[model samples]
Target: MKHWIHNKLAKVPAGIVIAALATAWALGAVLNEHGMARQDRHEVVRMTEKMKTVCVGRFLLDLPKEAQITFSTPRIDGFTVVIFPETLDEFQTRLAEREALIKAKPDRLGGDRNLEVAKEVRGDGGMTGKLLVHSRAVKEGTASNGLEIERYRHEGVAVEALMHGNGVSVNLASDFYFPDMVGNVLKLAVKLVPNPENKVPAEPGFCMDGAYLRDPLTADQLEQITMFARLPSNPDIRFLLILAAGLQPDKDGLIERDAATKSQFSPTERMRFSRLRAAPRTIGGIYGEEVVKRVHELNDSIVYSFWWEVAGTTDNIFVPHIVFQMDTGEGDHGPVPSSLSEGAAMGMWDRISSSIRVRPTQPPERVAAESPPTPLGSYAWAGERCPESGWWQCSDGGNGIGVLGGQRQYIRKGERMPQALLLPPQTLWEKLRGVQPSFESKTQTSWKLVDKRSRKRVPSPLPLAQATPVAAAGITSAGTGPSVMEQQGVAVGSFAATGLPCPASGWWLCDDPRALDGTRWFARGSLLPPATFALPPGGFSRSANSAKSIERRGAWRLVRLADAPEQAASDDNGKLA
Candidate 1:
């Protein structure tokens, strides 16, 4: 009985221990849940109150991999360009200095702790956001003892600094490229407007073409956008400048021929025009030339290629060409634009550099076979022989081979047979017919306008005369005189009736039959509405209006129609009746 009592006591102790452990586990879980809830709440509050400001910084420095650089100049108002260092140690020092500077000038920096953290954080997207740096490097070759010892090449690099609002957003991004020269920095001031809640990414005051432009201004209305170009940056990148301009036709058709010819337009307008013209052609030409020169200097095999587009009012057409010129006898090839086949250009590049290999991603697997065998025999393979059923063959014979016994067979019984073949299926002989692969045939030619003074070539604008009208009826015509109706505007319409001859130099005016109650009128003027007028078997011209009579000149005769009162007096005096 004593032993049994001892056993029961042992069981009781074990049960008590298990209960205590369960209670402790439950308490620990509750504490963990509470801590997580608090963290989530904090994050939500921080993001909700965050104010976003886009800062763009241009730095003339070599960027080291994974380097964290910061800028803390008081002069920087809206945007900031933080220069990255080439070495790890330099980056560290710069980062430390930036922190000290920020702490020193907290008021100028503003009250956003999240933004501050972003500015201070390191690593990709850690604090400030992602870093987009552009660089261009040029090296020169050297010649010794009457021989070329070394030639130095010039390179430019551009970098974009992006800062986030909540320290968690994808930082601003920019298109980066290498410049042709060194130590050149372009700075711009931009204003940004944030949403009412201020939690969203700061948007620029104006809608520009690309995201690289700076954004989101403060109440003081200050913002700065900066860009840097240096060597070691990607060469394929490009910058797009969005410009707005008032285009007015030259009334006199005379370009100013004076010393201050450039001042014909306002400074703003001139700058805008220059940027628009330069953005595509100038930048590309300058950079491409620099790249070629640099490659030559290094004695490395280099090739140059270029492709461009001629954008019409209706459609964008591509003109592609490849020029292979090499520095070290390594021949240059193409500067193909994106409009051309990227595969073809890459193939050319591969030929120049055998070490280069292009592995194209597998084409998407066809989800469904192309338009299942057309029921009407219009399908691409409809005329081919059906391997499964030897009986079903095109009228041209087996697989449209058009050979052997000339027995024409189409559909047999109720079974559908192949129809006529539109084109012969590609064969090995067809592919091998051209040894050169017709590369030059792919070349395209387009017309471009060249500025006389600048000697710059730009895609030409379509002429008004060559422009096809939208409506077939033709544009409306304005009156001969400068009436309000003429001034208001006239639509160009059909020219079926007006037998008026085409003008020699300036424009001619004519009224449509619809407007003149089936009567055609012709007049001479610089501007008039468009219409058709009926002429005599020959052509005619009208004289200016006079006080007495209306005179009409035609190939047939010169006739004058006088008032009716004069004719009435002649008849009354004939017989005194």
Candidate 2:
């Protein structure tokens, strides 16, 4: 058979023989590549156990029970948390290597990249801490022709403080345009308490009698928090979570659809923008959009990135933008090989993304009226259920109601707070909020309970001549005239005023002193009517001629969409009858 084949090949043209061999080699290469991709495509992910909840900013997300989580507010507008699938010691090795590489970079561009300041200091509560300051000097050289000035300097100074206690360490970093922040940064470091639980301790932990690190960023156009996790069985597989509140939004408090997302990519990025999945998704109670793309590079390696964002509003801290990115591959710039199959990566994303939700401040069945009243100065987010009905002052800084001088508002318990537009500063007000050149950004306001009296209260029966002015008695309308929707044309929290047309058709919560009937269905474009409360039979009977009932023009807030499944479960009329 070999002799016969050789004779046949001799009879064939040399060119044809060479062509056949080339074709076979090409076919084999294609098959090898196809097999590699298939291996990733069919990888299976088995979530063997129930998920555990971890708090990230104003929301909660479920993860594998074995995942180790750490929380940090690395930036004023950002919160970051890292979850390790393996033991902390194993992850530390990877981090140590990365840090060493960063430290080895040679100084260039007429600037020094040396660690100029490193010292150990004792913080409050006997906590030991290390202060690190890396400074790059401002370099000024003679102009090219000695006519102009040539200057080079890094943008800002960074002060990092690491506190060690309770077998855990807390890191806090601050960036300042000047070096004057060192003193304040030290002050902040001493006040930090490293509690592994990341919760407000019932009693002091390892820190002094001061506030632990929480949401301390009060700057406008600044909102960020990040969370990262990896699989314990496969530390190479990782997940990242990011939240940003300063992204600009439309009138409805949603990110400006495609334009905003497209702007995230530069010219080179646009070329690699291999879209995989892009659609609308609602995580927690906020309405937002998402885009998932697979990155195919020149080296034939691949990466899958996910982007999601919601509108920034004056109602809650869970506004602006959020992202969930996953990496299932080896690091250290080695050969790009994913640890998990593509199917496994997508399956994990679906499981965790679906579990994202606003952390419940109260039980679902707990009625606002029945719950204990929230005291003055208590803080609440916009989307959260109002703990007490009264006046709330927006402390989110120069945004929301402040743009129109209506920062303090009357909001009833059980009613959703509204949203407002935070006009970009035309002056130096930008520096006041930390980040200058502030653009139009939507962020949830941290509202504080200021008053405990509602507008249009049910007055006691008194003779007309003796009736005193509500304001004269130190009780005035907390209602700031028009709603944020009416004044700023931006609904703070998807809410509509009583006289305004309903922004959306849904169950609207009545902002009444007494939550009358909780929520009622309302149609879009229809005027939200007033909520009437009947007076108790003999509670206010100074005379038989006294008023028997009172009507309050309360603002109506959209609680649920008209298409919710529970809409059909109720048979009562869609009014507070």
Assess every candidate by TM-score: 0.19, 0.36
Supply candidate 2's per-residue lDDT for 498: 62
Task: Tell how far residue 460 is off in model 2, in angstroms.
Answer: 50
Superposed Cα deviation of residue 526, candidate 1 (Å): 7.6
Worst 10 residues of 1 by lDDT: 441-450
Give the least accurate 10-residue stretch of model 2, judged by summed lDDT.
Answer: 568-577
| Candidate 2, position 372, lDDT | 68
Error of 1 at 68 (Å): 13
Candidate lDDT values, in order:
0.27, 0.53
Instruction: List candidate 1 segments past 4 Å from native.
Output: 2-7, 10-14, 41-45, 48-444, 447-509, 513-577
Give lDDT tens digits, candidate 1, residues 464-568: 111122132253334333343234343223232222332111122223222212111223221222332233332434533312222222221101111110111
| Residues 397-463, model 2: lDDT tens digits | 3422123324566677788765433445455665666763323212334466755545422223421
Compute the lDDT for candidate 2: 0.53
